[model samples]
Target chain A: MNNAANIAVDIAIILVLIAGISRFRTPAGARFGNAMAALALLFAVAVALYRNPMLSSNATLAAFALAASSLAAWRVSAKINMTRIPSLVAFQNGAGGLAALLVAIVEMSGAGPAPGAVASAAAAVSVSLGAATFSGSMIASLKLSGKIRQTPTVVPGHNIALLFLSAACAAAAALLFAPGDPTSALVSLAFLSLAFGALFSIRIGGADMPVLISFLNAATGMAAAFCGIVIQNRLLIACGAVVASSGFILTMVMCRAMNRSLMNIIVGGKAPARPPASSPATASSPELTAAPPAPVAASQPEQPAADPLSLAADALRAAKKLIVIPGYGMAIAQAQSETVALAGMLEQAGTEVKYAVHPVAGRMPGHMHVLLAEADVDYDKLFEMDDINAEFAETDVALIVGACDVVNPAAKEKEGTPISGMPVLNAGDARSVIVCNFDDKPGYSGVPNPLYERPNAILLFGDAKATLASLIAKLK
Target chain B: MSDLLVMLVVFTASSAIGYVMISKVPQRLHTPLMSMTNAISASTIIAALLLFSSKLDSPHKVLAAAAVALAAFNVIGGFTVTGRMLKMFKKQ
Candidate 1:
C-alpha cells in the first residue's frame, strides 16, 4: 500500500479505537489496548522509516500478536475475579508514560546534534514532558495501589522546588539551541523532569487519583504526539492527539463530579471541613434501630403496596418537595433512565424533585453520578453529600431507590460500626422514607441498615430498574 | 497489504471482545484487572528497555539482565500488590 493510504487507514483505525476505549468509565483494559496500538504504530513507522516494503510482513505479525494477547486477556479476565484492577491500571499508565520517555531518550541520544533548530527543540520538549509524566505516573500509581502513603508527602517549599526545576529545564533547552551539546542538555532536562514528577505526585492526595490518572494520561499522550511531530509521523500525531484530548476531558469530568477544581487537585490542600458530631447521646439512640422486622424486609405487607403507593401518590399529587436517593443497586440495575423518568413524573406533578447523592454511594467514587449522566439526567439536579444533607429533612417524600448503605442511619447514629465515620445521606430524617431494594442482603460494608426498620420507612422489594419504572408508570 | 489488513482486523475484533468481557465485570474484579494490566505493562517496559540497552553493546549482557530484573520486579511486585487487594474481599 502507498504511504498516503496507509496513513489514512491507520489514522481511521486509531480514532475508532480511542473512541471505543474512552467509553469505559475508568477505562479498564485501556493500557493493554494502548500498548497494542503503540506496537502496531511503531511497526508501521519503522517500515516507513526504513522504506522497506517487506517490513509489512512484520507489521502483520505484530498485529496478530497483539490480537492474541487481547483475546487471552479478555478470557482470563472473564474467569477469575480480580479486585486490584485499578492498581494494575495505574501501573500500566505508569508504564505507558515510561515507554514514551524511553522513546524520547532513544530519539534524542541517537539524533545527536541535528542542525534543524526547530525540530530539535520540539524533540527536547517532548522528551522532558515524557520523562516527567513517566516518573510522576509511577508515583501516582504507587500511591493509589497503596504501595505508598496516601497522605501529603510534599516537603516545605515544594512549589519553590518545582519552579526551580522548570527554570532549569528552560535553561537547558536554551543551551541546546545555542549550538551546545544535545546530550548534556537532554541529560539535564531528564534530571529536571524526574524532580518535577516527584514533586507533582507528592502534591496530589489519594482522593484525587481518578483526576490525576486522567491528567497524567493526557500528558503522556501529548509527549508521544510531540515525539511523533519531531519524527514527522502522521499516524503517531493523530493517535497521540486523540488520546491526549480525551484524557484531559475525562480529568475535567472527574474533578467536577467532586465539586472540586482542577487547580485544587494540582496544588493540593485541605478538603472541606467535616461537620462536627452533635453528641454521644444522639449517637447512642436505640429508637432508630428498634423498629419491627416487617418494615426492614418483605417480612410482611405492612399495610400493603397499594397503601404506600396511595401515600406516595398523595405526596406526588399534593407536595412541592420530593428528593430521590439513588444507590449502588440503581447502578447495578442500570436504572438511571427509570429513576429519571420517575423524577420527571414527580416534577410534572408539581413536586420539585432532586437527586440526593451520598458520598461513596456506589462501588467507586462518583459511580451513581456517572450512571445518571449516562441516562441523560440533568447535571444540576444531582446534589453532593453536604449540599443535599440539610434539605433531606424538609423533603416531603424521600424516594429511596435501590439504595442501602448511604441511607443507613447506622453509619451516623451507631458507634463502633464498620462505616461509622463515613457520613451518609439523611434520607430517614425526611417526612417519610420509601425504600426500593432487592432483598434483605446487607450492603458492601456487610451491615444492615436500621433505617430499613423504621416505622415510617416503606420497603418495596424487586429489581431496581423494574421497580422504578413500575413506580414511574404508577405515578404517571 | 493482507498482513496490514489482518493486523487491523485482529486488533479491532479483539478489542470488541475485550469490551464485552470488561462490561460484565463487577467491582470485585477491578483490582485483579488492574494487576493483570500492570503485569503486562511492566513486561513491555522491560522488553523495551532491554531492546534499547542491548543496542549500546557496552555491557550488553548486563542490560539484558537488568531487563529480566525489571520483569521480575513487575511480576513479584504486581502479584504481591494484587494479593493485598484480594485480601480486602477475604472476610469483609
Candidate 2:
C-alpha cells in the first residue's frame, strides 16, 4: 500500500510537469497546468505523511508548520506587483536553496563518525551549492529591487578570489569523507560557499542579470537534487532534474540573445561607464533631468533641433506602414499604455502598425511583452526580432519608442565594439526613423549609438510617456 | 540495480526530458516557466518533512522543520505567483 502511494505520487508529479510543458502550445493549458500542480502537491503531501512514522506521533507540530508556511507564501504571492515578479522569483529561488542547505545541516549533524562516502559527498555538494545559491540569489534580488547599485561591482582579481574559494570548498568536501572530524570541515565549506556566492554574483552587471538569475536557478535545482540523493528521495531527484535542465536552457537562450558566451560572463567584465547627463533644451520635460548625462562626445551635432512632435506627426500622417520598437527605455518611462495609444491612433488613420521585440530588449527577458500585454496590445501584432527584421526596409517609418541600443546601427557598422555581434532590430533600415528617447546616452553596453545621428533618424527628446502623449495629440 | 544507480538513471532521464520539454515553451512564457519550475522544485519539502518527523534529536528536528518551512514557502509562493502571472497571459 505504501509503495502504491509512493508510485502514485511520482506519477502525479510527472503529469504536472507534462501539463506545464503543454502550456506553451495550448491556450487552455495554463489553467489545467495549475490544477494539476495543485493536485500533485496534495498527493506529495499525502505520501509524505503516510511514509513518515513520526508524522502520526507529532501530527500537530507538522501540520502547524505546513499551514503557517503556506499562508505566509500565499500572502507574499498576493501582494507582489507584476513589475517586481523577477525579484520575487529571485527570493523564492533563494528560499529553495536555503531549504536544501538546512537538509544538509540536518543530515550532517545526524551522521555518525563513519558515515558512508556517498552520503558525505552528497551532503557536501548540497551544502556548498545550496549556500552559494542562497547568497547569490539574495544579492540578485537586491540588485533587481534597487536596494543595491545595479551596475556590476567588479573587485580586482575577482576571478582569482573565486578560484581560491572554490578550491577551499573542494578541500572541505574531501575532508567530509576523510578520517578526522567532519563537522568543522562542513562548516568551513558552507561559509566558503556563501562567500563565493556573494562574490560571484556582485561582479555581474545589469545586462547579464537574466543569465545570472537563470544560472543560479539551475544551480539551486541541482543542489536540491543532491539533497535528494543524500536523503534517498526519488521525487526530489525528478523535480530537481526538470528545474535544472529548464534553467540551463533558459540560461543558454539568454546568452545567445546577448551574443556573449557563458565563459565571458563568468570571467566578470565591467559594463562601460554611462556618459555624463545631457541637459535637454526642454526644461518642462522632467525625465530629462532624470536621464543619464550625455557623454562629452555627443555624436549628433545639434542640428537646430527640429520640432520632433510635428515631424513625427507629419511622418505618421504620410506613413503607409509603421513598426514600433520598444526597449528598456519604455519600461523605465512606464510608457507602454501611451505607446499602445499611439499605435491605436495610427491604426485608426489607416496606417498598418506592428511591434518588433528584441529577445533581450528590456531589463529582463520578455519584459516588453508583459508590459505591452498589460496595456492590452493585440498579441497578433507583436513580432519577434527575426520575424520583423526583414520588414524594416519596406517600413515607411520605424518608430523607436525610447529604445536605443537594440536599434543602434553601430552593431552592424563597427568591429571591436561591445555589441558588435549582438542581434539588434533592423530599425535603421527603415526609410524614416524617429527615436523617442530622453537623451543620446548609450545603452547598458555603453556604446554610442550611431543610429541617432543617421540622416533618416530624428530624435524626439523627452520622457517617452509624455512624448507619446504629445505625438498622439498632434496626430489627432 | 543498486538504489544509487536507479536514482542516477532517473536523474539523467528526467534531465533529458526536461530539456526537451522546456525548449518547446515560447519566449513569452519564460517568466511563468521559471516560477513553475520553482514550484516543482519544492518537492524537496517531502524530504524535509520526513526528516523532521524522524526520531532525530531537538536540534536536528529544528533544522528539518526549518527546511520544511522554506520548501513550503517555495511551493506555495511559486505556484500562486505562477498562476497569477499566467492569468495575465490568457487570451483577452
Candidate 3:
C-alpha cells in the first residue's frame, strides 16, 4: 500500500472521531457520538491490520485476549450502579495507561531500528508518564470506590518530595541515551515517575478530586500520544492526541468551576482550617452585615425545631417554584430516587420544580446529572449552576438534599478560607431554604455555612434518603 | 526524518481540532464524554496489534498480547458504559 492512501484513510478516520466528540453537546447526541467514536476506533484497528497483517498464531492469541477482557468489562459495567461510575472510569484509565507503558517498553527495548535522539526521548518520557498515570489512577480508583480512606494524607515534606522526584525522573530520562545500555536509566525513570505520581495525587483533598481525576485523564492521554510517536503510528498519534485535548479541556472546566488554579489543587496550597464559628463581624457579604448575630440565628430553627419537617413540608406545599440542589452527599446516602420522587410530587402539586446542579457537586464533573438521570428525572428539568443561580431569588423554595458546600453562601462570600473564591449555587437567594443535609456541619471544604443560620431556612438534618422519603410522604 | 515531521503535524492538527470540537460538551454529558475519550485513548490497541504483525520473540509477544487485552477492555468497556449512562438521560 502506498503512503498516500494510508494517510487518506487515517484522515478520514480522524474526522469521524472528531464528529463523534462534537455530538456530546446533549445526552441523546452523546449516545450516538459514543458509538461513532467506537466505530472510528474499529476502523483504526482494521487499517492497522491491513497495513501489517498479523501472524496466524499471534492473531489467535490476540483475539482470545481481546474477547476475554472485553467480556469482563461488559459484565462489570452492565451491573455497576451510577454511583460507582467514577471509580470504574478511573480503573479503566489505569488500564489504558498500563497498555501505553507496556507498548513503550517493548518499543524502547530495540523493537525497531536503533531509535534516534528524539524518538528515544519520546519513548523514555512515555514510559515514565505511563507508569505514573497507572499508579495514580489506581490510587484515585481506590479512594473513589471506598476501598481506601478518602482523605488527603499529607506526607511530611510532600511538595518538596514531589519536586525532587520530578527532577530525578527528568534527569534519568535525559541520561537514557547517555549510558551504552539505557535499561538502568529507563527503569529508574519509571520508578521515580511512579513515586511522583502517587505523591502528587495522595495529598489532594477530597474537595479537589474532580480536578485531580480530570488531570490524570489528561496525563494518560499524553503518555499514549508519546508512545505513538515512538511507534510512528499516525492513527495512534491522532487518537491519543484527541483524548489528551478532551481531558485537558475537562480539567480546565472543573478547575474554573471551583475557582481554583490546577496548581492550588495538586500542590495542596489551600488549607482546610476551620473558620471561627459565628463571626458575624467578619461576614463578607455587605447585606449580611445588618443581620443580628448568634441568638436569632441559632434559635431560628429551634422555635419550630420540634416540627422542622412540617415547616419544610408547609414551605414546599406553598411554593409555586422550587429548585433542588444535589451534592455528592446525596449519592453517598443513596437519596437520588427519593429526591427525584419528591420533585415529581411537587411538580404534580402545581409547583414548578427544577434541579440546580453545581458543576463540582459530585465526585466527578457532571456526576450529579447522571445520578439524577438514573432516577429518571427529565433532562429538561435539570439546570446548570450558571443557568439557575439567578432564578433562585424568584423561586419560593430551594430544596437542598445531602448537599452543603455548593449551597454554602460562605464559599462565594468569604475570603482567606479554603473555599474562598469558589462559585457556589445561590440556594441562599431563594425566598425560603430547606436543608436536608445530614447535619448543620460544614461540607467537604470545612468552611462554615452561613446559610444554615438564615432565619427563613428550615434545617431537616438526617440521612437524606430517609429525610427525603418523609418529606415525600408528607407532601403526598 | 521527514516522516517524523509529518507525524508531529498529525498530532498537533488532531489535538487542535478535537479541542474545538469537544469544548462544547455540556456539563450534563461531562461524565459520558470523559468515558468516551477514555475509550479513544485505547487506540494504543492498534499499536499493540501491530506488534503481533511482526515476528516478535515469545516474551515480546506476551507483552503485546497483554497490551491488546488492556486496550480492548478500555475501549469496549468505556463505550458500553458511556452508552448506558447516556441512555439514562431522559426528556420529560
Candidate 4:
C-alpha cells in the first residue's frame, strides 16, 4: 500500500475506535463500544499483517502467541469477580507496557540499520517508560489487591531518590547514541526507569490510588506513542496518543474531585501526620478479624440507652427519603449485595432511595458503580457528588455504608488538612445519619470525621457486612 | 522529514479529538472507558509483529514473540473484562 492509502486505512480504523469510545455516553452503548474497539484493533493487526507479511516461521510463532494469550485472557476476564476489576486493569496495563518495552528493546539492539538521532532518542525513552510502567503498575496492583499496605510508605530521601533515578535514566538514555551496540545502555536505562516507577508509586496510596493509576495509565500510553515514533507506525502513534490523553483527563478529574493537585499526591502524600486533636476517635477498632457486636456513639452528652443498631433500624424504617453513600471500605467488606438488599427492602417499604457516589469513593474512577452494578443495583440510582449533594439535606436518613472522608463535614469546616478543600457528600445535613463503617477511626486520609459525633448520628461500627446483615433484620 | 511531520500531526489531532470525546463520557462509564483505552494502547502489537518482518537472531526473535504475546494479552484481556463490566450495568 502507498503512503496515502496506508494513512487512509489507519484513519478509518481510528474512526471506528472513536465511534466505539463515543458509545461511552451510556452503559448499554459502552458494551457495544467495547466490541467496536476490539474490532478496530483486530482490523489494525490484520492490515499490518497484510501490508508486511512475515516469513513462515515468524507467522507460526505469532499465531501461537495470539491464540495462547487470547485464550488465557478470555478465561480470566470471563470468570473474575467485579470487585477485583481495578487490580485486573492495572495488571493488563502493565502487560501493554511490557510489550512496548520489548519492542523498544528490539528496535534499539536489532541487527537492522542504525536509527537516526531522533529515532534513537525516542527508542530510549520508550524503553525506560515501558519498564517503569510495568514495575509501577505491578506495585499498584499489589496494593489494590491487599498484597501490600494500603497506606503510603515514604522512605527517607524518597523524593531525592526519585530525582536521582530520573537523572540516571536520562544519562543512560544518552548513552544509546554511543558507538558500540546499545545493549548495556539499554539495560541500565530500563533498570533505572523501573526503580523510578516503583519509587514514584510507593509514596502514593489510600484514596490517592485513583490518581496514581490514572497517571500510570497515561505514562504507559506515552511509552507506546514513543515506541511508534521509533518504528514509524502511525496507527500505534495515534492510539497511544488517544490513550495518553484520556488517562491524563481522568487524572485531572480525580484530582479536582479531591480538591488536590497532582503534585500534592505524588509528593506531599498523607500530609497531616496525625488526626486532629479535637477528635473523639480514641475508641478505635483496628482488626477486621474480630467482629464487634455493639456500635459506639461518639461524643453524646448522654449515651442513648437503646442499641445503636435498633436506633438506626428505626430511623431507616421511618425514613421517607434515603440516600446511601458507598466507599472503598464497602468493597473490602463485600457488603454490596447486603447493602443493595437493604436498599431494596427500604424501597419496597415506600422509602425513596438514592445513592450518592463520590468520584474518589472506590479504588478507581467509577469503581463503586461497577461493584454496585454487579450487585444488581440500578444504574439510574447512582448520582454523582454534585448531583446528589443537595438532596442529602432534605432526606430523612443518610445511610452511610463503609464510607468516610466523602461524608466528613471536617472537609468543609477545616483547613490545612489533606482533605480540607475536598468536596464531601452533605450527609451531615440529613435529619438523621447512620454510619456503618469498619471503625470509628479517622478515614483513609487520617482525618477525624465530625459526622460520627453529630447529635442525631448512630455509628454501627463493625464489619460492614455483619452490620448490614443485622440491620437487614431490622426491616424484617 | 515530511513523513515524521505528518505522523506528528496525526498524533496531535487524534489526541485532541479523543480528549473531547472522552470528556463527554459520564462518570458512570469511566471504568469501561479506561479499560477499553487500555486495550487500544496495545496497538503496539503492530510494531511488535513488524519486528519479525526484518532479519533477526534467535534471541531477538524470542523477544519479539514475547512482545506479541504481551500485547495480545493486553488487548484481549482489557476488552473482555471491560465488556463483562459493561454488561453488569442496568438502567432500572
Best model per DockQ? 4
Report DockQ per prediction, comma-separated: 0.05, 0.66, 0.84, 0.86
In model 2, what are the clashing residue pairs, if there are any? A276-A293, A276-A294, A277-A293, A277-A294, A278-A293, A278-A294
**lDDT of all predictions, in order shown?**
0.56, 0.79, 0.84, 0.88
| Tens-digit per-residue lDDT, A159-258, candidate 3 | 7898898888889888878746666777788788788878877776576778878888888888888888887888888898998998899999998988
lDDT of 1: 0.56
Q: Which candidate is the best by TM-score?
A: 4
**Across residues A117-197, which tens digit of lDDT does each residue of candidate 1 receive?**
655766676768767876887787677556788555768888888889899888877776666457677778878888898
- Winning model by lDDT: 4
* Model 2 Cα shift for residue A20 (angstroms): 2.7
Please provide, for model 4 over A1-476, each residue's C-alpha lDDT reduced to its tens digit, 9 standing for 90 to 100.
33687878989999998899888998989999889988998898888888888877677887888789889988988999888989988999999998999999998899988788878888887999899999989989999999999788899999899999989998999899988899889989988988988888888888899999899889888998999999888888888999999999999999999999999888897677655642444433433212221243323335555567767887898999999999999999999999999999999989999999999999999999999999999999999999999897799999899899989899999988788989999999999898899878878888888887666687788899999999998779
B1-92, model 2: which lDDT tens digit per residue? 37788689878988988888788877777777788787777777877887756567676767777888899999999999877776665454
Instruction: State the DockQ, from 0 to 1, for candidate 2.
Output: 0.66
- Tell me each candidate's TM-score: 0.52, 0.90, 0.93, 0.95
Question: Using lDDT as the measure, what is the rank order of every candidate, best first?
Answer: 4, 3, 2, 1
Task: Report the number of clashing residue pairs per model.
Answer: 11, 6, 0, 0
Off by over 4 Å in 1: A1-6, A15-82, A111-115, A272-476, B1-92
Cα deviation of B24, candidate 1, in Å: 21
